[model samples]
Target: MDTQTLKHLNEAQREALEVAEASRETEWTSPSFVAELFMGKIRTNLIFPYPEQSPEDRQIGDEFMKQLESFLKCNLDPDEVDRTGILPPEIIEGLTRLGCWGMKIPKEYGGLGLSQINYNRAIALVASYCGSTAVWLSAHQSIGVPQPLKLFGTAEQKKKYFPKFAQGAISAFALTEPDVGSDPAKMTCVAVPSADRKTWTINGTKLWCTNGLIADVLVVMAQTPSKIVHGKEKKQITAFIVEKGTPGIQYPHRCDFMGIRAIQNGVIEFKNVVVPAENILWGEGLGLKLALITLNTGRLTLPAACGGMSKQALRISRLWGKEREQWGAPIAQHEAGAVKLSHMAANVFAMEAMTYYASALVDRGGSDIRLEAAMAKLFCSEAAWKIIDDLVQLRGGRGFETASSLRQRGEKGYAVERMMRDSRINRIIEGTTEIQHLFIAREALDYHMKLVGAFINSQSSFSEKWKSFWKCAFFYPKWYLGLWCSFDWMKSYAGYRPLSSEIRFVGKNSKKLSRTIFHLLLKFGPKLESHQMVLARVVEIGTELFAMACSCSKAISLIRNNPSDLSPVELAKIFCKQSQIRIQHYYDALKKNTDPEDRTLSKKVMNQAFSWMEQGIIPDDGAGFQKNSETTVPLEEKRRYSV
Candidate 1:
């Protein structure tokens, strides 16, 4: 969109863009345009920041969990749990009683109307207790029912359907058919309209429907017509509310899954099932958008549950590592075991932080976040897989064998296997990882171009001069290429050189000399984490850095003077340092691959950290570290207070 930004492309960026535009020829799995520009590398220097939630939000999330724990303790009869599958009927009833299904439903519709933050916290708790139960709850409220209503349902539709969700009445979303899995465009579930256009006859089988076997209401997507319109084919997609006992609706029995077995998943054949026109959600042609919205929300939320599951596995691994000694000291003290623990901690923390950040953004309701959500989903899901694998390895022989009935080998194995299967589904479901890359590339390019265009537009007085400079600058193509290549190269090279360069730029261009304080903060970020203050300051620095970058681009548009003006340049310099410090803090908090002691401490602490997580304790809280007499907050509650 911004042509001036286009002019800023270094050679590597251009090359990457070229490669990405040609990605289809390479099975659409090549390195992304952004990757190519940044030398096919990721900058570990940049940290994604977790939401700086207010006390009210934290209290809300915490209080919600306290309520859950209370409900689980008071209402749920532990004896009702199926020891084999361990999915308690009382747990379901308790969730139903707690109004869990009404979490995201609007208050106007008789729901608690919790925000995204509350929803994630609840899901994490469920996932930690029982991954299957978590899946069951999330799959129903998240993917199965209210989502479609949110996207396509009319005001009347919302009024009618949303109220039912508060009752915890189960529903299933049917999209993946027997013949088609990821490709909804290829779906053959046809809903033919009646002669009077008042009703539609649905005919098709929906495969892999979670809660499909017993759902009281089903929201099914069907393709009614496919024909070319305005030189583009119009694919008529429609959704209908098919009650469980609809005349032509037939369940083909439960399709047993490897994991999440307690929650029934099955296929349903719609043999000329008849439904009223009033049931058509938001009318024809809106089904796909509704489905996409539902899927994207699920893609983002599912990973949060995965993060919890991974957290549980990591905790179990560390617990075993500490208790299960072999040869000499605890096996966890062994180097190999320690490495596994460290890697797991790093991944768990990163995924947790990332998921929260993404969720917060979604809650903010400003940014499109399609790309952000997809990236978070991709990273979090993949991280969960690796974390679980390492957990299994850390457990050794006992981990492989069935232990307690609650944590039996068959159940754990099936759950893990199911998670793996479901994990792959996320990659392909909303938009494949490859498709995500395309979106990421487009967004990055769009961002870059916007900056460039601003740079050009704001320089109206010197436009001719800049044009002349550019013409001569491009004459030496190699030099221009090298300039672009530098951005790519810097991504892979994590040394202080890039920071130093930014520092130099700031020092030269900064208007107020005091701005250098921010630059100094950025310079010490990596070192500070290496120091004892790894948990707090680093997060601040990462946040500063991201804020600085974003602010600098904004300043360029807002400021009148050009970069050539010393005052303008100085202002930009000051902003850059402030922003960089903020941005760098995010990465600093990532539970990184740090010193041996920090890593060890992080694992032990995070284990206890997780225990109190649903209770609202953060990782830096004292459960991982020793009690400090000097601090006002108890060691157990330091992280909770810090936020």
Candidate 2:
């Protein structure tokens, strides 16, 4: 965005964008499949083979999953855990005994050294049975100390902490505070350096720190002292490793949530908590980047877990669809129920294809998967939620009943209601759905930002602007013209005969999608980001295109080996047609929508013009809501928490 347009934003929006811009991975050192899609290019080679898990790796994961399935079947009672809001000690011990704690740690550290594919398989298996248990294991390593320590730690740091995870030590990530939800720029948590620079003192309250209540170690983010460079001051956020017995660390209360009832999430308070400088995982000014990088990979776990849950929903829906009759016939035979059932099956197939493909990319390494991972998280989470919602509707009243209640009435409980409650959190964690849209949009624009920023940036000198304007003038006409009419004869998907139509749609519409973004950018200029709905539509279109391509790629791979069963290809056809319908709807909305009217109405609504509209409803003022005293620290004291 240009400087003049930035001036139109409120202080909070400006600060958040500024901090996020500073920490962004500005260089695309490696090629990204999704990023290229935004650039009007499709590298079919990347997705064509649909990278498969090696035979040995598959055997290893299969053996581990078998053991995990036996353990969960024998010991886990998910309904009981949800009712009690506590995971049993014996279950945690059993997981540790099975080496779940060391699943992500490298074998050099005497840990499991599981590949990303294997780890995701294990997570998916666990999640199929219990949501709380999945969170318990994933939270310990996905975004926890082990992840950062392995990614950014010194050799000595890894040597010190890796062994602990293998020995059943739990860990947590502390970044979000009471006031700061998604933006770390507003973070008031501070770590102050000692006079000798040998120790750092941290003080702040971290809210919703998953696994914090019982974690043996923590990776805490805090603002350090700022530095002046090039006539500007830059904020510094640092990551630290704090141990369990740290004197000033306290968890005074645990948080109760709508779902995942057995999680050990709580408020963690740090008061003058001091640690040696060596505890810094990366460097003083690189904490936000570290967290973002860690999450780029950690986000994979959620989609796989979501796939697991989606599979379970499919199973329950299938059994109920046949067993329950309505209108004098099996529900599965009814038009509405039949449509949902077919789409549910098709969606599950695509969900597995997209997530497992991304996981395989991670295991393969050196591919820029930022866009791919974010899209996987966004697509799979939303798709899984929709699948579960359909399951509930299919089950009718039984879906809303608790499993225990159903069992008490002498009926077999499928746990649809519990799954719905548990699945809602996926859209909120890692990053919210709205936040992911913004993140994807920002990265999608980055390629153009680098190419033409000097031309459009208000901060640029007239001489520089003149050169950039002429550069774009010479470059874009040819580039923009190709997006409209260019045809690549050599770009035909060779091995994708069964699903060639879907592949062709993605290949063709990807260019149209990029062209649409170009026109929108031209129309809105630097103020385009403020037009969020328009950008969201563009993102959804691109996401659908990615899904269709993955589905086609995986279908080809599956049918090649079987040679007889083309069920996977048939699933791909259903999923791709579904995605095409969605894409067209998005395109239609992009051309015509009530955006201007919406802005005006939203302003009036927030200004209390609609207060009269709510006169019939019971009056509620939120006074009954309990505010935590621990987070309501005084302002003067909050400064004491800052650097």
Candidate 3:
């Protein structure tokens, strides 16, 4: 089945199809289940299987979660557990014992050595109770110390560090400073080499260092002067492992934050600190590369926290909407409330599906999953924020009160605020959204170029979408011209307002004209390279749309193969519809370029690209969802395991 045919299915039919395909061990409450429903039958059937693990790994993951959940039950809820914002030592010790700190470490080092998929499952569990807790745990797992060892550390470094580090030894990632962010090349921190290159001295201040107050180890990046080959003088930034109490390392009291307050975020002043020469990560100048790789790894793990938060937000809204009614019936039964709930559901489901896909890709050893990770982080963070915002709205005044679950606290709002800020940072970190687009466009263009070359060289004609797209190229000029005019009109209206009674607008200002202009701008408007920022946004939306489509398809296939396993596919289908409509809006928006010039070119280029995508796009030859060894809690198992 094609995209359109699947789009035509009723919600009930889609749900039924998904229910028939899921495994018996997966959870109904999971975003994975919802993701399946979101994809439906046709798309799912088309994109059936991606290889990675067997059902055994999934089982291990589930069992681990169950054990961890039982351990966390008493600690997670009940009583106001130190909301005064101290990183409790007890919690740290508990996490260490659970192997949370050593997940990425090799199995030989006493770490669980779990894959990215299982690690994210652990993160989701932590996030469900407290996003703050997840943040604290992440500081140790992602940034602290173990990461550098895995990515850039020497074999000896791993042997010396991974064993002890895996035992929950706290560590700090000292990078951010008072004046530096986003741009590390501009950092002023310096590390001058000693006479023999045997020991190096460091001096710099690192601000916003999580776990700094109690960490036993530190990964510090600084500038080092290296002799340039054929050049007079040179300096490069490098990273080093600084043991705690290394002379000159000092920690200021932890900095307070808007959210995730329980996590320790502090300032570390490296006043003439000293470290061994052999401690450098992949030698000098590779610090940036090491940082980027570690971040990519962290990005894979970030989405699960957001997924958990989104789930929590949905639960909050549902409970409040049902109990707090304006009319005789529950507010959830009302149209306005229903719309809000639907939107929240859609966002969460889409985020979850995308996260799952990204994790799966990473687990399968796909190296270029950075863009996917970024997309997951961006979408999931935004979705969680929206859900929380709506949940707050649903509670009206009560949600604003500090007495609500930590999810509704003023700081909870900040957790989202920071999450958004942090999420945006990632968008620009590994690659900006603009950069991702450039990467995507380049990939798309390459694929198309190959197709055209094949056709030109072999005289072969592609079928369906490709042929139709090639045909649409002739209509480019008309579309491009329309976009230019629409933009001109929009620019003209910027200074004018309809809110004022005296304001006057010109050039056929009716609903029809508005739509005509909008339609034209939607397609060709995004073609303006001069407005690269806007173009970046347009592409970002497009990427989300495409990714959502793929995710929905994947989920649907999973559900179809194991219906009893994915009962929640019914809910997922609703969310899938939501993603489709949202994506369509962007597509429709791109279609409305009133500028004639852009309309012309965009039509031709878009058609050309469409043809290429179709010819090159390989559909999943329905092997159905392979029974992977993913440790999942199917509805029946959860029911049986219920204490």
Candidate 4:
């Protein structure tokens, strides 16, 4: 159960235990629902009353936004960039002059030192103007070398890199490879120390590395030799800073994407690249930890960007809905269009609520927001996607047409199609939707996992087992009883009451969610991880609850400050109503509609049991298999039939 006993376990088991222990320690101060959710508790302090920026910061942000608006409007062209697949140098120069790259870096380091909320707001504004520009700026700071270096780099490292970052030098974080996507443990990149140990020779290929081609500095992760730790040889993953002109670093090929086309992304190859010993970030075996920790706040960029996308979609949809008429009146008057418009606006409000709330937590600088960040990214990305889709639906044929095509044809130029394409990547990048669900589930179940792990660990002594068993026994009963009895312990976190009905609804469901999780744990016990379908539902419910809490809290804050304006309150009600329905749907699915048979069938199909279905199409061909040139169709016919 302790670190010393970890040697008796396998690598995966040891890692899991270490992670759980680290998370437990983090929760003591941060008190995130990531661990507490499994224990049937809502740490309301983490989410309620929302977060607010200082007046000084707000004033700075206002000025920054005005400057940003003028700069973006005067400089960037979304349509031109989408066509050219590159951002103009002048625009990058302009952004650099505006200090976009150094927004998060400390002022002492020659950067603006904006709070997380303001930084996020900046990203949202930049993203609204151009997705390509957003990616360029975000990649430079969000997960780029600046972030990891700022978080884990030594004082000397900061001194060396901060000024360059502030001057708009592009930086990138290279961790992904052709074979490694979500699982960094499976990374094949290797870093071997020289005999003198003065330098490390890194050899690896990184794929889909954002800004890989254009970055001045790169934070690269590679496997070092396994070190003997307490009689066990543990593989070490270390992070190193490799400068742009490093002798053996090469950008072999640029990668083209379906969207965010202006990103200078590609494959980066490291061939015996020598990095000085001082370049290793946070020492050996901590690369993954650094990457994750860096991403904690870096993840906020996507949600903020998504919020901007949603806002833009809402704007365009509104215009199209009002100006475009149907049989008797404008489409805005039609129930179908009205529903999409309302949902789009409501979702944008919810996204802003969630994004800023999470950003505020980051700015507050104490909470372990791993769960909150993931939830915001997941929810906002998917919501933005839906909102953009709705925008397209509202725009009709014009939505599908290229902005340039529309312009040339003397129609309104709108990037609805481009926006849809760009928005799709938000769900896929940083972490996929499915990946986020699994991650949230893992963190949410950490407490339970640790308890069960302790009880069942064969390496544990009899005393430890009994201790764990007793703890679990007492905890479960009390937790269930507390839920069933409708404990009001979290009321303080909700703040001054005579709470809005929407806020009350969120508070009520938080308990219901906790109770549902408890029952689910009781039913599944240690085998709960295998029930991913159920876990996904649980995560979804928690996401909705958090979103509701955020929306209601923000509304309440607005109402308290401005008493006359009720728009925030109304919007919160709409969002909460939608979230309430979603929570019920997920709760119902958890109880009765898990679709196990469908899952089993899907697994079977994945394993190729249904290969015969494509028998006549191509012999011995599997999925993704294509026919040779000998089996060809006419160009016209291909054009006619191609999807």
Which of the numbered candidates is closest to the native, going by highest TM-score? Answer: 2
Ranking by TM-score: 2, 4, 3, 1
- Give the Cα lDDT of each candidate: 0.58, 0.90, 0.60, 0.83
The lDDT, on a scale of 0 to 1, for candidate 1 is 0.58
Residue 75 in model 1: lDDT: 57
Cα lDDT of model 1 by residue, 29-144, tens digit: 32221222222122322221224455787787788899887776565432233235555566667777788878878888988777776788888877765556666777777777
Q: Against the true structure, what is each candidate's TM-score?
A: 0.62, 0.96, 0.67, 0.91
- The clash count of every prediction, one per candidate, is 37, 0, 70, 0
RMSD in Å for model 2: 7.2
Instruction: List residue ranges in candidate 3 displaced over 4 A.
Output: 1-53, 77-82, 226-235, 404-532, 564-573, 584-643
What does candidate 2's lDDT look like per residue over 115-216, in tens digits?
Answer: 999999999988888999999899988999988888899999999999999889999999899998899988999999999999999999999999999999
- Residue-by-residue lDDT tens digits, candidate 3, 468-527: 456445544454354345443333432222111111111212212223323433443323
- Expressed as tens digits, the lDDT of each residue in 1-643 for candidate 4 is 2544334457765564454343232344566743455445555655556788989999999999999999999878888899899899999899889998899889999999988888999999988879988988888899998888878889999999999999999998898999888766667899999999999999989999998899999999998887786786666788999998989998889999999998899999998899999999988878877887788889999999999988999999888888999898999899999999989888888899988988887887877788889999999999999999989888999999989999999998989999998889998889899878988887776666567666766677899889999988988777678776865544453353434555556656666777776677679665565577888898998888788778877888888888998888788888888888998899888879837898989999999999888677636435576766777786998899989
